[model samples]
Target: MIRAYRNHPYHGRSPLPQTVVAGWLGITQAQLSRVENGPPLVHLDRLTHWATLLKIPESQLWFSLPSRTPTNRTQQIAVDLLAGAPQGIGLSGGSPTTLKATAHEGGGTTDRRQFTALAALAGFGGNSLFDALMLADRKAEVVGMEHVRLASSLVERFRQADAALGADELCDVAMGVHTRLSTWAARSQYSPGLGEALQSALADLANQVAWLAIDGERRQQARPYLNDAITRARIADDPREEVRALACLSLLVREDHPSESLHCAEAALRASRGWATARLRTLLRLRTAHAYAQLNDVGGFDREMTKARHEFDHGPHEDDLPFLQFVTAQELTGIQGLSYLALGRPARAAESFRAISSGPRAGHRRNQVYYTVRLAEAEYRCGDIHSAAQTGLRALPEVRAISSGRTMRHFAQVKSRLDRERSASAREFVDAHGRAFQR
Candidate 1:
């Protein structure tokens, strides 16, 4: 793949505009062009932004390093990080397994030409995605399993707190705990078996922290931790955890990069095909269905929802990963409703939301606010201006209780929609409730 990129560097540029790319890479247009043309040599300062802009798997995949071929370990790490979804993602390599490269008029320009490859890439995979990372013959530390179990307990508590409290200062606290646990996992003296287990736990913890950052809209802060989680989960040979991390990333990017998001969600499903418990399958398929809805692929969305419903009905399997306890019927219902909402079927969307009979529990406060606000939006879209305004006001208390920026945004959207109507209820709701949140 590197050889192909070196010969025809046109495909290396991202789909974003060149001006955006130049500014993001902190370079002049000419410099950005040179970097793209790639005899693959780049200065130290430029490489970080370059690799980042390209969305390469690891920060150290500085592909443009002069004439030096990377060490075996470095190359393997790069491969390991990307192997989870090699074919689907449109990074520099395109498809590692069966990449086909054709030289265009030249190698320097961004060409849309196709490349054909001999084989599609596949690396080490299965339940433990990173089973190969541990050193053989190492001895376990006396306190390893005990430490891992304690960390798992703390992670479970952190998740519960996130659901109830929202992503407030609690997110920072989770980040701190994750950092300390990750360092502890890296310290020497554990046996290979113990190290493997510790890595899985640490990855799971880091994923929880990353998810908080994502939900809080601190996206740039969330990405590296996600990368770390993916790497560790793969090395730990825990494909279930790897799938979980990938699904989070998929959800994060669905709005901004819907196609890439679809690929990522599908990749998560592919990674888990043989090993994921039914609940895990349900989670990934739900995410996939959401991506399809965003892309307006009605067929794809319906297909995934059907699969999700089947998985949910047959789930709560013994093989389910304990960390993913949040996978519940309510969450599934909300996602299905959301997909309908995205498709512009307001009546259908409202009907889906009507399935929930009562206010959400403390842990589902965010959902309570989110779905309620969504129901109001759907009602407004369906021409029930008075009902929409009244519904919006009813959800205000839950919105304020959760401290979720997302729910607050929903309130604003409902107000904006209702402000279009001239009804007394709409005008009153907008003046009293909507105005309070808009400012």
Candidate 2:
């Protein structure tokens, strides 16, 4: 239980202290500490209040308990409700039983009460979804979404949170929602709003997928999803959405059509201006700089890269977007490093890449692979074949796990370059993992 409490780390980072938390619950700090250190003996009411105030999910809090013991009938009912439908069910499934129990307890089984219970379940589901995503355990993520759908009201809340949290944050909630809704939509024969919602979710998923693809050097497969994301964004009737799609597309296509990439990215920036949040605008500009580098427009790349760095440095806290709250400053620095590499500035690229390479491993695995690949390429360009080979070797495991053609292509490109030098280790790594490069 102490391990669980300490592992979250978010609690320590929260502005509230143990005393504040205890005071809020009308308990002494020592009691709270004991609760934190020992088995979860805190009342469900107290736990729920603590979770809400701490911005942690109650499900996670419950799950963190040393033993899966339920304190009361209500807690047991909640556990059954959570376990019976690992994926959520409609108001009918076990909801009435729970509601009746609540009413009997003098809690008045109103629709509002039911809705609140559902929301809490969904919030728990969201936390589970986030955990699965962080681990890159796609199978677990899929299961988590089933629960998210039970808390259907969260979908709208996620959407509303998007504006405040930015695209990255939106992508977090959107991922599980997208997967769930897509399955639901297919099963329900494409219901109204479902298609639009799925499209919105897919657009976000595609961006992450595309990022993964690019990281794994599977550019070809990445392109289709990027294009699909754009189409979905257009259908969703949000210019800001379209801008994000186009910006990502620009990154995938930049090498093929640098001028067109720049044009598209510029257009996205223009469209997003004054319409999207500052983070969105900054992301668009970063995409433009990448395109500029591909076009060998050094001046343009430098200016835009500088702008991206400045904006990123002055950016809002990650907590502003609950979904993307995990994204750190180092990730943005990696982007700038890639921009430098694209502009043919090997030294500057190396500096940026080193920063990313040395940073903590907390973000997405795909992101780690992406920056590491860029660093390897930069090392190769700077005539450090040994470093490049080493980096390539390190990145191979992550690359193999990804299912993107673009990422494979990037790997192939790097491998091909290194293969010419007959580096035995590099060749061995390639021979072992080359199967993943296939389209």
Candidate 3:
């Protein structure tokens, strides 16, 4: 057991690098390696910190207890609950290390499965990336008015991809478009309309890149791109892009800075009040609802969600921004369900999840896994342990295929709940899923 921790496969998948994890543990990386590599003389306090950082189960850790514990397990529950686990940001993992357009030949290509996944994602993404890359390689004469159409199409495609794929699969491709747009803007001397159009394209792509960063679970790292998006949005004076940038900032800060989240949501609403299209307004209301949920303001959450649903159902989306078209009544339902989770209304949350999908679409694999695990959480919260575990177990195969910090967090949360459960079936379910996640 002591030897197992040295080369634990768990650290390989962790978004936090060893240096960052060691910092959180208040030790040097070399010290951490030494402590983790050698005998089981690491202190109880350090073990507690590791459990909290990695979200390990107390029961599982105690089964191979180190000999260094002083006495009784008085601190056992403290280690188990970890009610206030530190929310350290993960370094962006699985993304291209830089914004450079990666060459497909030589050693740049990833695994076959990753290529397949990227292909599937790009299919739903309308091959805009492929088209953009092709145009990017040609002279400026080859990039005419159609580049604008392709840029707009890219936004819509990414909106679909956002709902379907996990963020890791989305990040690098988004950055590629972002870089292309930047290069064109810097070198080409276009007319006023063309330049504004180019800036709009750049802003939207930057927003997508930043939003994907948030979705990929690297919110802190998203700040630079997000700021660039906001600035370009103001330059282009595009309300839709501004709304997205605001909502993303709101989403990013809702956990750590709820007040700021509310402010950002309000800023989104204010920016879009008269100039924005109806679908854009609905998106803003949803952002506001999300912030309200984070603050536990039930009335505010319900009100904004109701408005979001009503506006989405009745409003004309024909004139909406292409990317804004993704905000459907069905997607809003999922947001409402998530708000219920924040409000501690598991029954309502489960009901909402049930409405999002009666059946899964073939290409929307990641969405299926995410919603299934969410439903499992609601079931567990309502004390239906058997159904909860069974439902979650069904998604393990899909979950294994993708990597998302948000998805991993949900798994960790469910694991914590199952660990505290007294039911033998629940424990068994935890064990099965536990090994699956370790892979």
Q: On TM-score, who's better, 2 or 3?
A: 3
Off by over 4 Å in 1: 1-143, 187-189, 357-363, 419-422, 431-439
* Residue 28 C-alpha lDDT in model 1: 66
Instruction: Spell out the clash pairs found in candidate 3.
Output: none
1-439: candidate 1 lDDT, tens digit per residue: 3334334547455444555656765666655564554332211223434565555566355232322332333333322222211121121432132212222233411211110010111111221212322322223334244445545645665566566645643454456456545544556456664666667777787788778777665655566667878887878766656777899889878888888889999999888775566898899999999999999999999999999999989969643566557778878878888888888888888877666525355245566667888888888888888778888778766676665566666778888778778899988888877455555
Residue range 114-220, candidate 3, lDDT tens digits: 53466565583243233222222334533333444445545556666666767766665555556655665667666664555556666777788787777777666
- Model 2 poorest 10 in a row by lDDT: 94-103
Query: What is the per-residue lDDT of model 2 for residues 392-411, given as tens digits with 9 covering 90 to 100?
Result: 88888776654334445667
TM-score on alpha carbons, each prediction: 0.63, 0.52, 0.67
Q: Which should have the higher lDDT, number 1 or number 2?
A: 1
* Pick by lDDT: 2 or 3, better one: 3
Task: Give the TM-score comparing model 1 with the true structure, all chains together.
Answer: 0.63
Error of 3 at 191 (Å): 2.6
Q: Where does candidate 2 stray beyond 4 Å?
A: 1-236, 317-328, 396-407, 422-439
Alpha-carbon lDDT of model 3: 0.64
